[model samples]
Target chain A: MSTPDDTQFEAAFADLAHAAELMVDPVDSAVIHGRVRRRRTTRGALAAGLAALLVAAPAVWWLQESNGDENDPPPAEETTATATPDPTTADESAAEPEGGPDGQASEDVEDPVLPAFGDLVGAELELPEFQPDGGSLNDACPSGPATLADGTPEWEDGQWYMHEGPVWVLKVVHTKLEEGGPTRAVALIGCMPVETMVRQAVVVAGDGAGGWEVTEEVALGDTSDFPLFDIAPAATAGVLLMVTDTETTGMYEPVPVDYRIMRYRTGSDLEDVTGEAYLLGVTDIEASVEVTEGEDGTWRIELTLTNAGDHEAVGFQMTACGSDSFVLEEFDLPPCTADSEGVAVYEGLAAGESVVEEWTFTPPPSQEWSGDEDSGMYLLGDVRPTTYSAEVFVYDPDLSNNGFRVDVTPEDVA
Target chain B: MTPTRGTRHPPAAEQPLLLRPTLEFDDFYAANVRTITGQIFAYTGDRAEAEDLVAEAFCRALARWHKVQDYENPTAWVRRVAWNLATSHLRRRTVAQRFLKRQQEVHEPPPDGDRVDLMRALAGIGERHRKAVILRYMAGLTVAEIAHQEGVPEATVRSWLARGKAALAGRLAVHDEMEER
Candidate 1:
């Protein structure tokens, strides 16, 4: 009752079961399954791009499934002979947060005078040079929960974007060892905010035998554990650590000193790779300033603000602070009180929206003698040392990337 | 959210039908993913590609499990979708390879043994015949199901299956003879 076709088909089916055994085991399949499930939940940046944009659910699955080993463009892992057209635009898997040729342009729309989110210029800050082969991230992803609790040098920074969706692998600097050993990848991950800091570093290197070897992890200043931001790799031996010294004890204006240091051992020195600034986080607000002096020695300070991030920037405040000399000499205004007459606040903006506001103050009555007080310009050698500099602050709970000095007129205003 | 092991099932009206399929789908996934993956692997010739296609097929099924579960054979649905994913992947890769070959000398990754033999045999049998054989053996699709998917007569499908299998058997016999020598 068995035809040649029937028996052969049975044999082939059995052979296929054997082949399946050769390919992916139950654990491997579960890993793939978990990844798909995780991707559905943690698609921070992927949710906006082509993956989420596709109308067909199957297309998204196709793109996700096709993502092959790290190093080659996913979707186009192109192992399938029929050539599944990768739905991912920009040449790889859903163009996530970093490293794209067109990255700066997106960040450059620059929201209104918002605080400088510390030159987080962006992950795409380093490209073409870094994404060698464009396929590593597909494999470089962490296998389990992305947590900094262990600080284990695990490849995957198992954190979700804002803990909402999409595993945000925010910053990864991929470099090979000196003599071309295994490729080394150091990524700055932001998942859960412990004390408002979601920064952690996980280093992974090639095992020289095709698998990845996670090497090191340094975060929040390991010792102080102050939430670190603007983390990027130092040229050679180690990484560049930048943190807004938030815990700088009481009193005195929080002179937001941007601390960026090369964190490495003595024998090994950090080198400069890219001159471009790679920020760990992104800020929604952008600030710009223009100063115009009126006929009566009065000056009109104009400020503008814009919101370019996905979230709404609420309670926008632009505060102008100054040293004693500049406060009294440059603006004839009352002695600079903290945020009194020195601050301009506005209702926040939704993404892509902008707002403008202005404040006017007259020059100091006595210092107008120009020829006498070191060019009468606030302070000279200590030139603008006493001059009022305006800083914009959006009510970010973290306030880490939310404070920046706005440029005022008279010096380098043009 | 999925109900835990001991959790009581809510009354029919209170529970959404969509949410109810999780357990069923899990069972189905556990039962079929391995089989479907092997089937896809044999058809695609690359383990990673096959795995990807299988996962993609399952992902699509998960999205529409409510309807898929209603079908007489949900696994067949996954197989069909997975086949599309694999073929599309292959079609894309072929174009890239052709383009690369035009510009420079391109080397292909070595195909595995049984898969290579199967691929060559399928090619010898011709596209339509090969599709029927694959749907029958690799995807576990019955002749009528292949006929339905291919929009052909059942007799035509059976004929393709017969010819494709004969071609495969001939090729394997030759391979076996060579190996023995």
Candidate 2:
């Protein structure tokens, strides 16, 4: 005996199937084929071009010098040779400024003295205006990958190479900053290869308190193949820029150039405290609550703590608050010796940090109780002397308790 | 193309030279291009992005022709690529849309049928549910096939199908009521 709902569902499913058939056509397939061919040719051309550049660097330099007048003196090849090594090192060093060598500000010394694009003056560098070339690369290309249709390299002769690539320019206007505060509405423009999409662009504002809050997340790009041209708030000073290559070719493998940023602000300048506190690193924090039915049919509560922090948080304590109706069930902490409170504190947590702490508890058996119903409700309190923010909720079912919270308190900072 | 009839079994010890088949660009486009475009169009509700995604999907497929050709359904393979490309596009678009003063026009309801509305509703019901609906109803795939593709248990796929159908019905009913009003 099928219910009316079942019959209706079957009908809708059939209708949907029919509609899909209508949508699919041979013409669509042809378009896909053409796109694939173009992409293959572009990649092959790009690879070949890169190889040419590697081989032709000295030859090109010689050609330019030979064509020049004798008075020019060919601009000392020694300086050029010495200059190249430092910038490569400097760029690599700047890539991880927070954890860079000797804990010194590399940008201060290198930006002013660098041979190419000398001086780190923000005002001197002009923002490229928004323009659509209509499949022409005549204008100065943005710093990122060239969206030009032709395989012409965008970076040419120390200037942005322009080509008919997938590039969209967004106008950022109406900029305002809060009085006496670090500039808000600061505009941040990020450029990457069209292959990499900007995932999340956040401007972290220093909370008057000792924490950082993401004030805004700049919008991603419109075209998947084309990288984002502009991100905001266009006027915020000292913004942390981020771009994510969302190509999921190999799900397990990390995307090359997966995370890159020109972070303007640091914890020292933005943090409320005067003393030095480095941003050791960041890791995804995860906390969950488990509910299990007891022999008596009562639901029990079990709290599990996982150290998802990038650095080992010494003497870390996670306190969770939940309804008193359920008692703490069995608790176990892996990779760390269990304490009296069922807390597991590891010596250190590396990248891809994970800790599974489970608490099993029986809820009060009674008026139609299901463990899954109330499983998601748990309170997470703030982590004291906060090194990281804690996310407390059930991700499996995407449910949150109105009052449940988790607080993390740091102890004995060296 | 007709298959050649022969009693030709290559010797076990002989390393067979894999013939890199020439892909007919026209045939490939005819089979997959629009589905890729449509997937992006549906995901982003943007024509420009849909076109870009279609182009990129084909580009990627072209780059990995040997692997793509080996798949049972190359169209499905390209469609998945387009879907992923569309997702990235939307992620970037969300950022662009946030700062833009004026929003682009929402996709209009199709005049001929409620299919567009159904698709819109499917889009609203989260990616997991949308995938379930798309794979089962749109692709005409069975529950087990969907489970295998999604890497979930058959029971879970069944649950998603049930929940998705209910959610769609509820949304449609509300939409109809709004129209009536």
The number of the candidate with the highest TM-score is 2
TM-scores for all candidates? 0.34, 0.37
TM-score, first chain, each model: 0.28, 0.23
Name model 1 segments beyond 4 Å from true. A1-5, A26-414, B1-19, B100-125, B138-140
Choose the strongest candidate by DockQ. Answer: 2
On the 0 to 100 scale, the lDDT of residue A149 in model 1 is 17
In candidate 2, what are the lDDT values of residues A212-237, reduced to their tens digit?
A: 23355433332344333222221122
Candidate 1 per-residue lDDT, tens place, A240-355, comes to 55554452211123233334433532234443322332221223455555677777766666555666554444334443444343442323332233323223334335567777
lDDT of 1 at B179: 79
User: What docking tier does model 1 reach?
Assistant: incorrect
Q: Candidate 1: deviation at residue A291, Å?
A: 90
